[model samples]
Every structure is written in C-alpha cells, then in structure tokens.
Target chain A: MKIALLGGTGNLGEGLALRWGKLGYEIIVGSRKLEKAEKLASDYLKKVGDASIIGMRNEDAAETCDVAVFTIPWEFAFDTAEMLKRQLAGKVVISPLVPMKKVGDNFVYVRPEEGSAAEKLASVLEESSVVAAYHSIPARRFANLGEEFEWDVPICGDSGAKEVVVDLTEKISGLRALDAGGLSNAHLVESLTPLILNVMKRNKTGELGISFR
Target chain B: MKIALLGGTGNLGEGLALRWGKLGYEIIVGSRKLEKAEKLASDYLKKVGDASIIGMRNEDAAETCDVAVFTIPWEFAFDTAEMLKRQLAGKVVISPLVPMKKVGDNFVYVRPEEGSAAEKLASVLEESSVVAAYHSIPARRFANLGEEFEWDVPICGDSGAKEVVVDLTEKISGLRALDAGGLSNAHLVESLTPLILNVMKRNKTGELGISFR
Candidate 1:
C-alpha cells in the first residue's frame, strides 16, 4: 500500500515516513515546495536503504496515495485539507494534529469549533475519511529507529478508515493502536497532548507517551 | 495530619482509607449516616491492624480534619460541597471527581460550568483550597493493597494545598504526583478519565490506570 505524509518536512512526518518505508510500504513525502520535499525524501531514503520512497508536491502526493497522513501543524492543516479535498476524496487520511497553544508557563488544548482537530479536518475534507491517531507520541523519539519503547495510540474515526489506520499503526515498531471510538471522541485524544506536555514540563520528566496499565 | 474521606463508603474512599490508614495518618471516614461510616472505618481498621482510623458525620469530619477529600460521586459532590462550606474552610480539599457521562457506547467528559469539576468545586467553596488528583486511578485495584502498579497522578490547584496533596500522594507505594499547573488546568486532567474509559471499553483492556512513560 502507498502512503503519503502530506507536508512531511516536520519531525512527525519524517518519523512516519522512515518507519513505514523500512517495512516496504511506499512512502510519498509531500511538501508545499517540490525542492524541499525532494531534499527530505533523499535524506529519508539514505536512512532506509532499499525502500520505495519518493517526493511530490502536496496535490500530486494526495492524488497518488491510497492513504495519507496530515502531518502538518494544526494551524495550516485546514487550508491544506481544503486544497486537496478532491484528490484525497474516499481515501483514508490520518490526523495526528493537536490544537494547542502556550498560556503563560503552561500549554493548553485549544478546542476547535468542530470539537477537535480531526473533526474539523473531516468537516473541511467532507469526502475524505479522516481518522485521528498519534497525538500522544513524542516525535523525536519515534524518528530514532533504535529507541525501543511501548506506547498506546488511540484512534478515533467514523468509518472503516479507523481499522485501516489501526492496522497501519501496528506495523510500526513499539506502538499499539486502540480503537478509542468515533470521530466525536477525537477531542479526548487531542487534549492529551497538552496534558502530557504540562506533566512533562512540571515534573521535569523529559518526554512522556501514555501507556494503559 | 488528619484526613477526612467525605462520603467515605465508596470504592474510592475505601482505597484512600486503606492506603492512608496503613501509612499511620489519622483516617476519618465520613458518610451521611454515622452507622455506615463507623462500619466501614472498623472494617478498614481491622485490615490495617494498628492505625488511627475513625468514623464521623460529614460535618464533623469536615470540621475535624486538616485535609478533606471529596470522595463522593461527582453528581452528589456539589451539594455536599455547598453544605460543608464553612466546615471545610481554611483546609485543603482534594477532588478526584471526574465529570463524565455515557453517550451511546462511549464515555464523554462533561465540561463543568466553571470549566472542570475542580474549578467548579473551587467556585463553590471559596475559602477551601481545592486540588484535583486521582481521577485516573483504578480504585478497585488501589484498594486491593496487594496490587502492585506504577501510576502518575497529575495534580492541579492554585494554593499550597497542592504541595500537601502531592506529599500525601507520594506516601502511597505506587503513585508519583505531578504538578499539572493551576486549578484552571484541571479540566485537562479530569477529561483523561472518560478518555481512558472509552479506550478500556472499546479495546477490551479491562480497568486502566494511566502511566506516563
């Protein structure tokens, strides 16, 4: 199966690209700028030798992939969703978006008008199957292929897209995917980012990924 | 210091009673009916062997303790908080109340009018130091005494009472208390309960307590 990491220049996208690419799934690194996408894809290819990986513009990547992940920052994701709605229609699009902002010394979850970032993306994409997952992952740790850790990834969505994302998530090493419920439940997963960030900041614990015990 | 478990007949209260009673802190088990409170207190005393554990009416317990935990169900805690306002004044109060309800098959966090349950309690008991903690603990497992598990408790409050509660939580064998900013941030911690519940239900993972790793 082919997967596109839309705006794959960031840490989260890089991690997903590397992990999936090594497992022999085609990884398309999408960026607003073609040159930047190509540069990152070449870097990623060096990391995962003998793999199917390529660079494309956002629209081109969205049109080509069987599945896509919105790895963009939440602020810019809606606009990108609007631009690529047609290309990504009927395709499963995973969201790791967390809408959060700094308030004084603490980070707070900025609840979107549509309840959560995933729901908001779904609303904008209309025809795309939007699934929420990966909000709690510490991206830097995940990108390092050697870092062995156990973390639970809670997935929320309305359609069969959730199962596809769940299966895709399990293929990545050291991560377990759980069905948290429908798209309406996405806020619960999104809010966890700021909550974990607050815990890490206050407790002097480096980075935290939640585990169900 | 003396600690009161207001409405102390519940599972949560029983867990706190056992843990604190074993640590030799004076444990006051408070309930609406004096007989019920005394019965449970005696049961706990037998379990702990030699410990300072007693029973009292809610009013007496609130007035008598240095710290008070609102161990009642979230639905009844507000009225109880209103009733014991004067009695609990100038004393530290902990709220493990998670405002959540079942929506279809999923549990959803009901954002209280004052933002979260802790903030709402703070609004009602203006003179009390309201701190939020223990919302994510699996009380049945905690009460077992033999169940060994590592869990992180995120605590939020605006006063020195947070420190007191933090120290108290650390006294429990398997808990690490984290400062999750002020009372306003309590909603972040409160919402985690329903999130975990949804995860547990959909994933069939049984009762889940959170671990920050």
Candidate 2:
C-alpha cells in the first residue's frame, strides 16, 4: 500500500518514510515546497537504495496515496488539512497531532475547541475517514529505524476505517495495534502525549514510550 | 506512615487498603458510614491476618492519617473534599479520579471546568498538598492481592508532599514510582484512565495496565 507522510521534512515524517520505505511500501514525502520534499525523498531513497519512494506537493500527494498521515505541528495541522480537503475526500487520514503549550519548562495539553486534533480534522474534512493513532510515540523513537518499537498503538475511528489503520499498524513489526473504540475518544489518546512528556522530563529519561501489560 | 482510603467501600479504595495493609502501613478505611468502613476493614484484616487496618468516618480518617487517598467517583470528589476541608488541611492528598462520561457504549474524557480532577481538588482544599497518582491501574488487578503488579506509577504534586507519595508508591512490591512534575499537570495523569478503559473494552482484554519504557 502507498502511504503519504504530510510535512515529511520533519523528524516524525522522515522516520515513517524510512521505516515504511525499508519495508517495501511506496512512500510519498509530502511538503509545502516541492523542492524540499524532493530533496528529502531523494536522500531517503539514496540511504535505503529504494527508488519507489517519491516526493510531491501536499495536495498531489494526498490525491495519489492510499493513506495520508499528518505529522505536522499542531498549529499547522488544521490549515494543512483544510488546504488539502479536496484531495483528502474518500481517503484514510491519520492524525498524530497533540495540541500543547510550553509553560515555563514543562508542556501542558491544550484541548482544541473541537476536543482534539483528530476531531477537528474530522470536522474540517467530513468526507474523509479520520483515524487517530501514533500520537503517543516519541518522534525520536519512531525515527530510529534500527530500534524495535514494542509499544501498543491504540487506534480509534469508524470500525471499517479503523481496521485498515490497525492492519497498517501491525504491518510495522513489534507495534501491537489495539482497538480503542470510536473517534470521539481521541482526546484521551492525544492527552497521553503530555503525560508521557512530563514523565520523561521529570525522570530525565530518554524516549519514553508506553506499553499495555 | 498512616494512609487513609476515603470511600473505602469501593473497588479502588478496597484494593489500596488491602495492598497497603498487607505491606504493614496503618490503613484507615474511611466511608460516609462508620459501620461500612468497619465491616470492610474487618474483612480485610481477616484476610491478611493483620491488626494494623482499622475503619473510621471520613472526617476522622482525614484528621488522623498522614496521607488521604480519594478513590470516590468524579461527581462526589469536590463535595467530599469540601465537606472535609478542615480535616484535610496540612495533609498529603492523592486523587485518582478521572473526569469522564460514558456516551453510547464508549467513554469520553470530560475535562472539568477546573481543567482536571486534581486541579478541582486543589481549588477545593487549598491548604492540602494534592498529588495525583495511581489513576491508570486497573482496580481489579490492584484488589487481587495474589497477582503481582509490574507497572510504572507516575506521580505529580508539590515537591515535599510528592516525595512522600512517591516513597509510598515504591513501597509496594513490583511497582516503580516516577515523578511526573507538578500538580498543575495532573490532568494528563487523570486522563489516562478512560483511554486505558477504552482499549480494554474494545479489545475484550482483561485488566490493562500501563508501563513506560
């Protein structure tokens, strides 16, 4: 299956592109600028020696991919979705955005007016199947291709769309996909990011990831 | 140190009472009715064959115990704290309450107007040092004394009182305590309950608990 990583110049997008590209899935690195996307995609292709990966503008990438995963910062998340709404219709869209603000040295979750990032995306792109997943995993861990991810990835959305995302999640080795009910529960999942960040900050630990036991 | 389990007739309250009682802490099972508290405490004592556990009214429990853990439902949390305001002063209080509502077979996190359960509890009992912990653990698992708990317990509160709660958390065998920053960040901790519950319900899994690795 083909996957498009929106905002693919960033750490999370780069990580997903590398791992998924290595696993033989066609990866499209989506960005605002075609030049930047092409550069990153070319770099990834050179590293993995895989020519199937390509780079394109966000709109074109969304139009062509089976799944579009948004790894952009919270501020740009909605706008990006809004701009690509025409292309994203009737497609599976994944949101891993966590709305947060830095207070002093710590980060606190800022619940969006729509309750969560995924809910907001669901509202803006009514025609798309929005699934909330991969929000709690640290970008550093996901980007580290050599490291095995042994964490539970809880997915929430409409049943049919959620099954597709779950299948995608399981295809990535060591990621156990869990069905966490429907899209309304995305706030709880998004809230986990700040909690995990706090734990990492206070404990002085590196790359804190969660597992369900 | 003496620990009080307010609303001790409930599953979570009873579980903490059992575990701490067996670990040789003076466990005060507090309830609205002294008789109910006494009955539960007596039952716990009979099972553990220990005389350190006792039962008392909520007011008396808060007054005498070094730390008071509120295991009551979200609706009664603020009122209970407000009613026992005088007794809870100058004591370490722990809140494991998650503000959530069940909507059509799934649970959604309802952020209180005060932001989180800990924040609301702090507002109600301004003199008490409120710490939030133990929110993500399954009540059934904690109640079953035979099963060993292997999970990370993240705690957040003022430095001095948080240390006391952290010390207590680590006293339980197989449980590791990690500092999760200040009490203002407690909402993130409280929010984990509904997320874990959703995963457990949708997957038909038995008693899910979180671990940070």
Candidate 3:
C-alpha cells in the first residue's frame, strides 16, 4: 500500500519511512520544505535500496497517497492534520503524537482537555478517519532496525480504520499489535509514558522497554 | 527539627537526609539493618558535621524523630508506612515515590487507581498527615549540594497540613514549594516521567530537566 508520512523528516517519521519502505510499501517522505523532503527521500532510498521512495511537500504527499501518517510533535498535530482535511477524506490518517511536559529527570503527559494528541488530531480532521497508534513507543528504538519489539503495540480508532492500523502495526518485523479499544480511550494509553519514565529513573537502568503481561 | 529517613542507605534517602541535615535539622539514618544505617549516619556526620545524626533500625528511627520520610520503592511504601503508622501519628510523614513501567530506552508512569504514590500513602495513613511531594523531581539533581534549585516542586495534601509540608520543602535549600492543589490532581504531576524519557531518547541528551513558564 502507498503511504505518505506527513512531517516525515522527524526522528519518528524517518524511522517509520525506513521500516515500511523495507516491507515493499511505497513511502513518500513529506515535509514543508520540498527540497529537504526530496533530499531525505534520496537519502532513505540509498540506505534501504528502495528506489520507489519519493519526496513531496505535505499537501502534494497527502493528495498523492492512499494513506498518511503524522509523526509531528504534540503542538503541531492538530494544525497539520487540519490542513490536510480535504486531501485526507476517505483515507486513513494516523497520528502518533503524545502531549508531554518536561519535569526534572522525566516528563509528564499534559493531557489536552479533549483527551490525547490522537483525539485532538481526529477532532481537527473530522472528515478523515484518524487512527491513533505508536504514541507510547519510543521512535529511536524502532528506528534502530536492530532492536526486537517483543511487546504489544496498542491500536485504537474507529471500527472502519482500526483494522488498517492493526495491519500497519503488524507489518513491523517484531511488533504484536493489540486492540486497546477505540480512539476515545487514548488518554489511558498515552498517559503510560510518564509512568514508564519514573520506573526507569528509579531502577537506574539505562535500557528500558515495555512488555504487556 | 529532627528528621529520620527509614531507608537512608539508598540514593533518594541519603540525598534527603543530607539536604535536611545540612540545614541544621537533626537526622537519623534508619534501615532494615542497624549497622548499615549507622555506617550511613557516620558518613553523613563526617561529610557535613551534623552532630545529632543517629542510626537505628526502622521502628527505632521513627520512635526518636519528630518527622520521618519514606525514600523507598513503591512496593515497599505501603508495608513500611503501615509499620511506621503508630510512630508517625502526630508527626509528619512524607512520601516520594514514582511508579513506572520499563520499556526499551524509555519509561512510562503506572499511576495507581488512587492516583499517585503520594495519594496512595495518604489513604493508608489516615492518622498521619501523609503529604505527597518530590515525586516528579530527579533525586540526583537535588542531591548536588553545589547546584541551585530554580524550579517549582508541586506539593499536594490535605489543606490543614499543607503548611508543614511546604515548610519542609522550603528548607531544602532553593526549592520553591507550589501548592499543586489536592491529592486527586497528583496524576497530572506524576505522569511527567515517561514523556521526559521519550524526549531524552529522541534528542540523545543525557541530562534533561523541566522549567515551567
């Protein structure tokens, strides 16, 4: 399937592009900067040996792709998703943003009154199906391509889009995709990040990961 | 004021004992093993020259001190607080525990249904004024005597006992104690740890801290 990663120049964006590109899916690395996006596309192509990868401005990427995934920061998720409303209609738009506030040695999830970043994105893109996935997982670990994903990746969204996200999640080599209810239940899952950080700090272990028993 | 730390041999406990002791508060280092606590007490005496330092087992430490702080793991917070309840009434008991679940190069906060670790303690100790503070801040940053605390420490509790806990917070050099409302709001403050870890992991910054605007 064809996927355009809006704001795909980010750490999480770049990682997802590489991951899916390897699985024979068409990937267009979208950016606000056309030249930068094209350059990243070429760079990723060189690394992954996937010549079909392309680069385009976000609007063009959205228009041309079957689905679009947003890997933007919490602050930009709503605005960016709103801009693509027309183009993203009848298409799946995935958001993996988590609202965070920095505290000493750790961060806390600053919950938006409407709920989590995914819910916020869905609100902005009312015309599109917004599937929330990959908010709690760290992008760096997924980017490594060397590390194993031995845990469940919770996917939550409307019924029509839920299976699509679960399928996307399963495409990753080692990840197990689990249904964590619908999109409204995001706050509970998104809130898990801060709890994990506290455990890592207290245990004094540099390498930390989650496994749902 | 005389303060006893029931688990003073460890990192968080030792740090708190030193911070309070440096401010002319008599400190008692208490542990499961009297010998270890005594060794820790002497070490503190040598470093800061606080003459009133004493070492004892957990119960004895609670019996002799005017106030006590639990600087142990979340699992131990309940049992230890229960054991010290008889000795802690009519005296201040502080808890500083953050619950986290480990994930690869990351951590997530596992907020108890009672809300936070501090709220959990307060529920167990109805007689003792179990005030929740210091759950969000990193102990290592506060452990450095040379460093300055130009940050806010969110202190939450029963309004009647707020002053005493705020006073304890203010005594710790430069920390400004901000009333973070009631214990129910503890989840918002406690949820910061994992979000910080995600930022650290993504940015590759070893030392990161939060500053409220």
Q: A70 in model 2: Cα distance from truth in Å?
A: 1.1
How do the residues B25-132 of candidate 3 rate in per-residue lDDT, one tens digit apiece?
A: 888998989999999899877766745687999999988887788877778878988888888877777777778776654466677888788888887777777666
**Residue-by-residue lDDT tens digits, candidate 2, A1-213:** 889999888778877788789888999999999998899899888877854789999888999998999989989989998999999998999988889988987888888888788999999989999999998777887887777768888888975888999988888787889998788788888888888888888899998779988
Rank order (by DockQ, best first): 1, 2, 3
TM-score of each: 0.99, 0.95, 0.56
lDDT of each: 0.93, 0.87, 0.73
Real interface contacts reproduced by model 1, as a fraction = 0.93
**Candidate 2 segments whose C-alpha is farther than 4 A from its true place:** none
Top model by DockQ, which number? 1
Model 2, B1-213: lDDT tens per residue? 899999877778878888888888999999999998899999988878865999999999999898999988889989999999999999999998888888887877787788678988999999999998998878888888888868888898875999998998898887889998888888788778888888988899899889998
Predictions' DockQ, in order: 0.90, 0.84, 0.04
lDDT of 1 by residue, A121-209 (tens): 99998998999999999988888877888999999999999999999999988899999999999999999999999989988988889
User: Which has the higher lDDT value, candidate number 1 or candidate number 2?
Assistant: 1
**After TM-score superposition, what is the CA distance of residue B60 in candidate 3 from its true location, in Å?**
18
Q: Which pairs of residues clash in candidate 2, taking residues 3 or more apart in a chain or in different chains?
A: none
| Residue A205 in model 1: lDDT | 87
